[model samples]
Target: MTPHSSAPDLIPGDLPSRWNASTPTADDVPDLHALRSRHEVAAKGRASAGPEDTRSEVAGDGAAARTHVVVRDADGTARGWATAQDRAAGRVLVAVVVDPDLDDDTGDALAGALFAWAERAGVAQAQARGLAATQLDSGAFEPDARQQRRLEAAGYAHVRTWWQMRRPVTADDEAERPTGPGVRIRAVRRESGGMPDAADLVAVHDVLEQAFADHFNHHEETFDEFLARLRADPGHRWDHWWLAELVDDGAAEPVGALVASASLDDDGRTVGSYVDYLGVLRTARGRGVARSLLDAVLTDAAARGRSGVALEVDADSPTGAASLYRSIGFETSYVTQSWHRDVVVG
Candidate 1:
């Protein structure tokens, strides 16, 4: 890790100067929060995360590492910020926010400094493990043409497209309840303290792994990583989880599982339910497991007064999952583009 003072300091007049990039400390929280707020406001109410998410990203589990950079004006007011996380596959995930009004040069310089930090961090980790590869993953909102161009100019190649879809819940929409033989959908059981049991956690992980095995960019996350990552989200709720079991007298374990979480808007109403993961094992596929699990979630969302359910799907998924979501009444609201750069070791 770089020493706090070793990073370059920037001033307002130095519009294109290098900015200090390092791990976020307690003192940097306020500036990071302010930077996030600026970008969120500029995004016109489309941003999904806030300060809490930033805090959690910095405090990641030991397996992963995070770095946050802040650019400040001469008077010490924050002007830009960036965050990058190192995941298991040697890929560095980056999200950056700069003053939208800044000159193009300033924006480019800020982005350059952040990527430099990521490169250094990746190299350091590889050297420690005697490995030779590091990569980067980034996403740009499709509506932001300027950012999209900037990313491409910086040598990132678009690799995948993600669609954000939503469906509004209605009494009529719930009329077509799912019913099939030997299939049962139930709410995830919660303990007295409101925490889910170990079995529930395992089931959800199994379902997600099996469900996404054939999907685009599908990679198996270790059980520990899955639990840590899910629990890290502030929006995670115990009651919002669900499971699907196949009533097979001969089977020793449940056949399928689905995990859904609800997120509320500022008004405290359950505005949407996000299907975090839904899957059925290979042996259980085509037996109505997926539809039944989805119906269970939809029923719960309608009963809770939620306006709709939302999820992201791979635009090029081989399993035709997008069509399934479309069948369930989800409509494409927006698209996000994923850019990937191969890791180069010096």
Candidate 2:
């Protein structure tokens, strides 16, 4: 058996003290739930799940790629947790959530242990498979002072900043869908569990791949990875997907498509519209395809009674997508940072 397989399975009986560091079981549910609840309250409800849910969601039976670790005090009280997911382009995204009351040293020790585990398992897998370097991203909604210090001291450097902005939906702000010459927007219609239309999917992927190709730290993600990752979300909705089609003189097939969806909070309120992916083929750029897609999304949000739209963009993006968002009434709400470190593979 591999080292990972040999890792101990963490369960409830073994809990209330030290975690097994290997397998995560159902008994860890309540503790994990509490951790998530605390983290969300501390983060002003920005984050939902605690360590247990995170582990189950990412490393559980349906997980595509995951690395997880738990932190505990001497008496076995869970103190902190960390996890990372493997995404397209062979990149691993890391997150560290700790109890605010813990001392800097304790937090650091927990985060450090998690990172070290990731380096050994997640990072090692990526390198051996010829994947790109790993990336660590951390977000803080409270006094992130200690969290930030821990990351920096652990050799993570700040790379990007983002805003978690939101706006209230109102009938007055609502407007009819925007359309320009040769541009049309419509909702995605999937017949069954089969994949979305092949041509449409390809166009959507092409548009996003090309549109963000020049942006900061841009990397290519496989089509399968993109589809699998989004579908894995418990909140994913088929009707929530949309596409922007650009026609030639209103006669030819669509040359571009955009995919977007709405995400609800635990209360089931239509909190916001999440742009899962947006794209416009090179042949369709500069013709308002993107603006048309945004209009459709906005219209949908307003109809659904959503409060606002939320998405992330690279702060140093070269293509100036941020400028477009600003023009559309999106603004910065919070900032998140990215850190990178080189990896040596065998």
Candidate 3:
């Protein structure tokens, strides 16, 4: 395996004299946020992920090996940003966004360069892992035609579509939460130290892993890997997690899991909550496990004075999860598509 210290330089050599590339840092958070916000507003009519989310993704709590690149003009102003991380063996995630204020031609050129930079970084990550090839995974909002065209230009294929859904919160929704028979939903147990019990945390992981075993892009992550990625997120709150269980004869078996994070507004206020992941095991499919868990999320978000909850669901789910979410007051706000490319390490 290639050593980290000996990793290849990812910056393109063909950049104009007025531009330079380097790994992103906390200082780039603002520029990164602005770049992403521009895309957000253009695609979804408003922004969702705030500065902290960008900060954490750029230099936050992630166990996965990653490298980020930001292009700056001669004035040292950030003009482009991209993130490429080795999420798992043979799987790399790349997110590339350029300054939206640039003229069309300059913006397109910068984007192409950044996308190429991310791909080369992904290859290095795969090589470091001693892999022959790796799959580069990236996504774009459905409305972002520019991003889609660029991804195709970078040799990525459109693979999957997801529904970004949201539901406004109200006291009445919380007061009327639904429950499942023989099932109970609650926060994962915490020890006296205010940290969650390791056992319960593992149960949540197991439930999620098993729950999504048959789902699309089902890459099994090690427990340590799972913990590091979530904990690194700035919006992650312990209280935002819930586990649904089947209780009978003095024993409880976890059947569903819901992991959520804070949704921040422009002024850094907690405006809503985002459901990062929600899953129910096959054995618990018809038992209302998913609904019970969501009820807990909606109730908690509402009680906290958060405006609403947002989540992404597979647009083509065989289980009709999007329909269920719609019936529960969630609306399809926008759509996003995943693009992937498999590349051999040089």
Candidate 4:
């Protein structure tokens, strides 16, 4: 990790002399929001990052273990931003956003600087954990040519494509409730202390772990880490989580799980629900466990008068997850590409 220094240094390669990198602070939310908006518009012709989204990323997370940096002009105008954090099992998620007003060469150089910072931070995190190798995870919208080039130059490969899908909530859709074969869906059990039951929480984590064991870039995260990450999100709700059980002759345990969070509109109004995870054990895949869980969440959202439900799926998922979502009226809103590389640290 680079030591905290206030001096300005030129980023190697083609960036203009006036642009310098510095650590970011909570006061930069407006600047970060502007950078993200310009990046989104240049890439997708639409703005995706909202003020709340930017604020949460900039201010909500515990700051001790994460790296946040921004690049600004000599006049102190923010031009780019980047964040690096350890997420999942052994993966570091690096996100970079650059203002589109800069020339192509300068923009590319800014991205390279951010990527280099991310790799250094990621390698350090892996070494601290006594791990030899770690995965670097980042993404780009399908249409961002500049970002695609930067990722390629940074030794990241295009690993997978994902589709952001949305389903409209209507009275008719709610009426078509799903009926799984002896499957029961209910909220995660809570203890007397008003916290999620430990055993049930572990069950949910286990189900998800086993379910995605064969999925792309599969990594096993500790149950404690899983719970911590979910609870860290501001939108997390206890009642929004559901467990699926297959009952035969009155014997049952959790066979699947569904987790969701509140989704707000651009204006920060609660508008819908977002499916964070929907996983079923391999042994329970064909028993309609997933369908039951999805229907349960959709029904609950409709009852609350939410606009709809949104979820992301691997476009080429071998489990036919996208097909199932399509059957339930999920339409693709946009696509994103996942880029990855493996870094080894001594």
Candidate 5:
């Protein structure tokens, strides 16, 4: 499924001789955002790439500290881009996007070269942290056959699929919300100046850590990293966060947490609420904790006059999480696949 390019100056790895690669800067946000949108529309038949999203990806900080590179044509037009981040010594996340209008060969070459760069960068990151091994993880559209073939050519294996789910906001969506007895749901506590309370943040992180312990690709993320990541999002707001507590014998325990963010349209308008994370402790399941947390998000979104709610779920989750979302009105919008490659750099 490689793209056919008539260009005669193909390099050893199929990269075109006329193309140049360089690090992206803040000035490239507009162009990069457009490139990402084109790639998204080509891969998923929809455009969700926004300028704010591009800005965050380039300038954000946290556990997954990313570095970006852009590949430009001879005319100085950006034809492709790749970004990489490391969660740990051997665990890395990489993303590659290309101009959909480019020839198949150009697309293949860009992906191939960028993937190689990603592997090398991931190894260097791991070694700098004193690690002995490296793993490069990336994602692609399930519908893009050429991209899949390109990934396979670069030694990556497709491991998981995720469904982007969405539901329209309605006044009746939270009509029957119930947290059951001894359960309470409330926003994360804020200080006098409207700053989030540190204790509440820690509680939310703890609840999430315990909730996702048995989930797929679960990793141990520090509380600081968790906070930094959420704050790094352009749409993040402390008021959009919530915690569900269980009261037992006058002692309150945080059993669940929900993080919501504003989803912006391509024009920068707030269109909906994105359920960034919804987690409930194993011991808190079947007690309406997840339901209550979701209800809070929907109700909050409706109150803010936002369009609806959106989230992604593991398509093959053993807990039947997708079913739960479907029961509450969410439906699959699109599907994406995860690919991984392991490199030994010791």
Candidate 6:
């Protein structure tokens, strides 16, 4: 959810002649999607990424803050892909994947070379912003030992694990959702220009910024940065934003916010809604603000006949969020681990 930085795409060194690497192109999307999808299916028993997702990652305006490389073998067969997205001022999201069928030695070399290129790309972004160091963050499915080995070999440490959870939605969700007196959720107001009301947008940003402050890996992202990044996503929909407020004594105080995106398959069908961020203020705890915001998302998804709502949650959520999600029917579909490596800009 960030714009492409001024960082130039950096290439890996010492790659064998059999593997050709270059910045990805529109024509390269299908091959890249196939490669990653195969890896995803093998790792998670199903694919979570779509071809559009790969297109955005490698090409298009979505690559504005991203630097990516797609590798083709001697016969011009796509075999690997790597990307480093400038997620924030000093944070880069990195991905390095190879064809699941590659020989052990070939996969190791390819992953290493791609990861090295990503670090260079991250360093380039950091250097452009005049930062000393930037974090290279990436993830792998919990069952993907090969990926874990590559990450550890590339100097990344497994820092955290997350639960990718999803819950089916139906007509009954809206009617059966819980309620809290004096607390209600509403859509972000839009102006005539079709843009969200500035005040409402700021309120949503402020509420989320404050709500996640005490949470793990909380980063201080500016409002402008937040909007630009979210709007850059291909799945972003302005109408999917909402805020929960406590209307007391004729005043509505924002207490929670939820930001979701449309989840699409390779064929571009909206299969579900993915909750990108949902947070409730500390003062609003135990008042069901979090649940209410989720209910809003579920209702929206159900109205459109979306199959389900999916979200990623911290395995050890401090607020007992996991249990609440479980009570709402969310089941862990897969597990992913966050691996991180810090790079110093040259």
TM-scores, one per candidate: 0.84, 0.81, 0.92, 0.93, 0.92, 0.94
lDDT of each: 0.69, 0.61, 0.83, 0.83, 0.82, 0.86
Candidate 3, residues 74-182: lDDT per residue as tens digits? Answer: 6676777888988978899998887667777787787788888888888988888799999999998888888888889889999999988999998786684658998
Candidate number achieving the greatest TM-score relative to the actual structure: 6
Q: Write the per-residue lDDT of candidate 4 for residues 135-187, one digit (tens) a residue.
A: 99999999998899999998999999999999999897566475698999989
Per residue, candidate 2 scores C-alpha lDDT tens digits across 1-346 of 1122223332112322333344344554455556666666665646643343354464553355665665555455556656666664456676666776666665566666665665556565577568656554445443456656767766777666755544455674477755868777776555577556665666566667776676666678888776777666655666666566656666645555656555666455546777766666666677887777777777778888788877776677655667777887888766666666555554
Clashing pairs in 4: none
| Stretch of 10 with least lDDT, candidate 2 | 1-10
Question: Which portions of model 1 miss their true places by more than 4 Å?
Answer: 1-6, 9-23, 26-31, 40-45, 59-65, 125-131, 173-176, 191-194, 250-253, 266-270
Q: Which 10-residue window of candidate 4 scores lowest in summed lDDT?
A: 1-10
Q: Alpha-carbon error at 112 in model 3, in Å?
A: 2.4
The most accurate candidate by lDDT is 6
Model 4, C-alpha of 90: deviation from truth (Å): 2.4
Candidates by TM-score, descending order: 6, 4, 5, 3, 1, 2
Stretches of candidate 2 off by over 4 Å are 1-22, 40-56, 59-62, 74-76, 131-143, 172-175, 192-195, 251-256, 267-270
108, model 2: CA deviation in Å? 1.8
Clash totals for all candidate models: 1, 8, 1, 0, 2, 5
**Candidate structures ordered by lDDT, highest first:** 6, 3, 4, 5, 1, 2
Over the stretch 173-240, how does candidate 5's per-residue lDDT look in tens digits?
A: 64547776888999999999999898999999999999999998887888876777788788888899
Cα deviation of 134, candidate 6, in Å: 1.4
